[model samples]
Target: MKGATMKTTMEKLGIIASYSRPRVSNDNPFSEALFRTCKYRPDWPTKGFATKDDAQAWVKSFTGWYNEEHLHSAIRFVTPAARHAGHDRATLANRASLYANARSQNPERWSGKTRNWQPAGAVWLNPETEISAPEIRDAA
Candidate 1:
């Protein structure tokens, strides 16, 4: 594997590879999480690979989807690109404003900024876990 060759070359050049103690798995938690996500994705090949090219292609596609369309519930139910591009903030704020009005109005009608807001009846029960009501106070 390329890993062995690289390690060997670095060792030959007196480049010491420093790593955390083996017992401390949390030292590379992010790396561990990425590998876990990649391996457990729904589209991953069930029977493993027949060729290096195939595996590489799958990895490329997976990385693109992961960085593009995948909704990370942990990050306000948006993809990384949307968050990085600033759309996520706007989206969250708009939704929160609508919901805040819905909440403040005591269920008479969807009378917030989204005038077209229908009850969607029980659909918002779970609601957005990430969004918070804006700091602005309700109108008197």
Candidate 2:
């Protein structure tokens, strides 16, 4: 009601989004979880920008990475792309098959012992999920 009177003075305006008649905070738990994730992400750049363009660019980058590369363990560690494409399950199956085939093809390629291969020697790839590699390839 007060918003109608001060419409001219408003710095920003948005629709009065309303939820179904549930006073429980659980009704909006998803949004709360999102804010929690945003605040907790170590890489979330929080410093204000001098110009709007800078703010827009940062938002753009964050959106791209969030939607493309971020993996949610709740969603089976698959990127949003895989989930959107409805191929998350298929993609996972393919990856598993590839691993099995690779191991079967050349057991010597991967030593019997597990190798520490995160930053250097070897790497895993995911093609279906935007979090995945652009292309699946042998571990470097």
- Relative to the true structure, how large is the alpha-carbon lDDT of every model? 0.65, 0.58
Model 1: lowest-lDDT 10 consecutive positions? 131-140
Q: TM-score per candidate, in order? A: 0.56, 0.46
- Which ranges of candidate 2 are over 4 A from the true structure? 1-24, 95-140
The number of clashing residue pairs in model 1 is 0
Predictions: Cα RMSD each: 15.4, 15.7
Q: Tens-digit lDDT track for model 1 on 1-140?
A: 24877766655554434466665954556677788898899888889988999999999999899979898766666678877776777777777686787678776664434432221222221244323223111210
Error of 2 at 51 (Å): 3.1
Q: After superposition, how far is residue 3 of candidate 2 from its true place, in Å?
A: 8.7
> How many pairs of residues in model 2 come into backbone collision?
1
Clashing pairs in 1: none
